[model samples]
Target: MTDWNGAALEKIAAAEELDLAPERPNGTLRDPVTMWMVRAGHRPYVRSVKGSDGPWYRGTQSR
Candidate 1:
């Protein structure tokens, strides 16, 4: 398993606000889309607003 740095981990844990998005192959970010964030243990996750059918979501899968 991979280990995360304490300070970086804390930053994510302490975040009350987040602007998360998946990167495109061309190195640009997808259109600004809002999604909920959830944490389990020390890991954070974001879900697709358009679910699997979302363009941004699909873009991530292709990479």
Candidate 2:
């Protein structure tokens, strides 16, 4: 596995403090709507706000 630098880790930690969620790099804002994000230790995780049946969720399953 790859390791995270202190700055990257801190940035992620700070992002977790906000209610805003970042958009997918390749996705348009209106396409998937809101995303829910969280940090566990040094790792980040994201989930579709629309749940497992959401378009974003379905897209991930196919890949």
Candidate 3:
């Protein structure tokens, strides 16, 4: 897997949110969902406000 570079990580750290579209089993992207992002050290993390029950989160599981 490709890792995030320093510049990319820095840009992500400065952002408050991101749009995610998980790919479906048929290899198509689902609708984009806007969610908050958190930076812990050099790592970035995100979650749905509705937790695992969220449609976007559930979409991610399909892959």
Candidate 4:
């Protein structure tokens, strides 16, 4: 697995939003979903404001 460097983490944290395109079971990418992200210490995290019922969140579970 790839690890995040300090610079990359800073860049992502600086952004107000990010786009996530989750892969489907068939290996095709779903539509990009705009999401809010945060840098927690050395790790990055994201969540669906719409909660678990959000379409984007559900799509991620498929992968």
Candidate 3 yields a Cα-based lDDT of 0.80
The clash number for model 2 is: 0
Error of 1 at 49 (Å): 1.2
lDDT of 2: 0.63
- Per-prediction TM-score to the true structure, in the order listed: 0.60, 0.57, 0.74, 0.74
Error of 1 at 5 (Å): 5.0
Which 10-residue window in model 1 sums to the lowest lDDT?
A: 15-24
Please, what are the lDDT tens digits per residue for candidate 4 over residues 1-63? 356899999989998788888777789988887788987788888887666899987766775
Global fold similarity of model 1 (TM-score): 0.60
What tens digits encode model 1's per-residue C-alpha lDDT throughout 1-63? 565577776777675545666666689976676655666776767677678997767777887
Candidate 3 matches the true fold with a TM-score of 0.74
Count of residue pairs whose backbone atoms collide, per candidate: 0, 0, 0, 0
Task: Give, for candidate 2, the lowest lDDT window spanning 10 residues.
Answer: 16-25
* Candidate 4 runs further than 4 Å off: 1-3, 60-63
Model 2 stretches astray by more than 4 angstroms: 1-3, 16-32
Query: Which regions of candidate 1 deviate over 4 angstroms?
Result: 1-18
Clash-forming residue pairs, model 4: none
lDDT of each: 0.69, 0.63, 0.80, 0.81
Error of 2 at 40 (Å): 0.7
